[model samples]
Target: MAQQVRGVIARAKGEPVRIETITVPDPGPGEAVVKVQACGVCHTDLHYREGGINDEFPFLLGHEAAGVVESVGDGVSEVAPGDFVILNWRAVCGQCRACRRGRSQYCFNTHNARQKMTLADGTELAPALGIGAFAEKTLVAAGQCTKVDPAASPAAAGLLGCGVMAGLGAAINTGGVTRGDSVAVIGCGGVGNAAVVGARLAGAAKIIAVDIDDRKLETARGLGATHSVNSRSTDPVEAVRELTGGFGADVVIDAVGRPETYEQAFYARDLAGTVVLVGVPTPEMRLDLPLLDVFGRGGALKSSWYGDCLPARDFPMLIDLYRQGRLDLDAFVTETIALDEVEKAFERMHHGDVLRSVVVF
Candidate 1:
């Protein structure tokens, strides 16, 4: 039987999301239904509302979420009903070439619910990141649900589903931040601060945070940044170099995902250091660097997709760390609002006043 649930939806391009009665089908093969407990308001959700992601109208928004599985479909074993899990966008296909070669993090084909969710009148809805979660209940691939400690707060744990994971992965997995390394993260939003936290966890000697917002920089400091640079008043590359003994950081992460921030990350790394781009850039944004300079820079340039994280491995461990009070997951949750306030949360997120506004159901 199909279930009717209240959900936030973008009915048309650049339209405000509205609360609608969405029809969720019973899970099909390899799928499960999750009763969302908490969902974080992420910029990506707003991007979807603005039609920045694609021409997919009537998108079921929200991805960063944690919930309990209510039901499972045939052939689903990874997650069973009553399990507490964090929803992940990347449900790796083990048969893909990336998985066959032992690099499932780069899974060429990810999984999503085979069944389609729709409006009461039968308008098909596209779920954000294949796990539309800004609703009371959502359907997703069984693999998309990563089991975690049930004791953790849903608001905090759900963040691990997206931005937090992306930031930490940018530092630890993609940038390869290590003990005694000097790292600089550009853009101290949720992702940038996460990089700071990850660098600290990895024992980085110096973590420089660069951002135009003072409030975000202050938050970054609390997350373990050794120094904060306001790019609006300072040249971030030069500031980072100055903070790193006139050389440059061992790793520079571009969490802002803009061309200017990308350029700053490029020039702020040590000659042989790594530059990790963890930010999501728009389609029209271009990077024009001197070809000779690109050749002159002796470093690896990489992009992080979903922080290059393996959900099963990273989620539980991070939750355990949070449980131990070693990682500050609570720091990311600035405010908890209701589902109806998601649009307002997006405003706060855009204004840079809040790191995260989570919806508690």
Candidate 2:
């Protein structure tokens, strides 16, 4: 049976999202229906509303989410009813070449529900990142659900489905910040601060946070930054070098995803050091760096996709850390809002007034 439930959707480009009655169909083969408990208002959701991702209109927003499995379709064994799970956009297909090589994080093929979710008038919705979770209930591929500790707060645990995981993995997995390494994170947004936390967890000797906003810098320091740089007032590359014995940081992460910030990251790392780009950029955005600089750097320049995370391997471990008080997932949540308040939350996010405004069901 199809169930009609309240959901938030961007009916058209540049329009405010509104609560609408959406039809969620029962799970089919290899699919499962999730009873959403919490979903975060991510910048990507805003991007969807603005039609930045693609021409996929009427997007069902919200991807960073946590929920409980309500039902499973035939042949679904990865999750069962009543299982607490975090929804992930990347549901690795084991048969992909990357998965066959044991690097499922780079799996070329991912999974989504076979059936389409639709509006009351029967207009099919394009789900944000293939997981339309900003609803009371959503249907997803069984592999999209990563079971984790049920005791973890749904609001905090849900974040691991996206931004937080991206940041942490940017530092730990992509940049390879190890013990005693000096790391500088350019951009003190949620993802940047998570890089700081990841650096600290990796035992970084000095974690330098660079951002235009003083408030975000302060937040980064509290999270784990050993030093802070106001990039607006100072040359970030020079400041980072001065903070690291004039050799720059061992690793530099660009979380803002702008050409200027990326340039700063390029010049702010030590020669033979790594540079990781985790920020999302627009399609028209381009980078014009000197080819000599790229060759002379003598280290890796990597782009992190979903923090290069393998959900099956990372989510449960991170959730456990969150439960043990090692990881402060709660700090990322600035406030909680109802589903109807999503448009208002977007305004707050645009103005940088909150780190995250999660929708609690």
Candidate 3:
């Protein structure tokens, strides 16, 4: 039987999201329905509301989430009812070229549920990132539900579904920061701070955090930054070099996603160091750097797509780390709000007032 549930939806671009009664059909083949326990209000949700992602209006907002499996459809063996899981947007298809090559992290064919959740008027809702989880219950591909330790708090664990994972993966997986390496992370937002923690966990000797905001820098320090630079008043590249023995950091991660920040990251690394771009940029954003510089810099320049992570492998391991108190996932949850407070949470996020304001059911 179809279920009626309350969900947050953006009826149009540039409009505020509102709670609506949505109809979620029973899972079809290879799908599962999740009863959401907690969902984080991410910048991506705001982007969806603003039409930054696409013209996909009437969007079902919220993606970063943790939930309990409520039901599973035929052929869905990945998850069963009563299992605690963290929802992910990417559900890798094993037969894809990338997966067949043993790099399932780069799976070219990821999927979501085929059935549409609709409003009472029968208007179709486009799920955000194909895992709209702001609702009381959301339908997703079985592969999207990665089972994890239920002892973890829903609010903290759900964050691994997106930004936190992106940041951590940017450092540990993408940047390949190793023991005793010097690292500089630009933009000390939620993602950037997570990178600081990642570097610390990876045994980085010095973690330099750069940002225009002092508060964010302070947060980064608590997360494991050894040094901080206020980029607004200082040249981040020079500061990083000075902090890293005049050569530059071994790894420079640009988490701001702007061209200027990207250039800063490019010049803030050692000759043989790595530069990882993990920030989300606008379509109109462009970079114009000297071709000579690109050739002269003898390092790897990489873009981290979702931190180049494999959820099934990373999520569980990270949760274990969190449980052991090695990872401070709780620090990322600044506050918790009800579903109706999502708009206000977005405001706080845009104003840089909170790392994350989660919606708890």
Q: Give each model a TM-score.
A: 0.99, 0.99, 0.99
lDDT of 2 by residue, 90-171 (tens): 9999998999999999999998999999999999999899999999999999999999999999999999999999999999
Question: Where is the poorest 10-residue window by lDDT in model 3?
Answer: 9-18
lDDT of 3: 0.95
Residue 35 in model 3: lDDT:
99
- Against the unseen true structure, what C-alpha lDDT does each candidate score? 0.94, 0.95, 0.95
Report clash pairs, candidate 1.
none
How well does candidate 2 score on lDDT at residue 61?
94
2 or 3, greater by lDDT: 3
Query: In candidate 3, how many Å is residue 155 off?
Result: 0.4
Error of 1 at 130 (Å): 0.6
Q: For residues 19-131, could you state the per-residue lDDT of candidate 1 as single tens digits?
A: 99999999999999999999999999999998899978899999999999999999988888999999999999999999999999999999899999999999999999999
* Model 3 pairs in collision: none
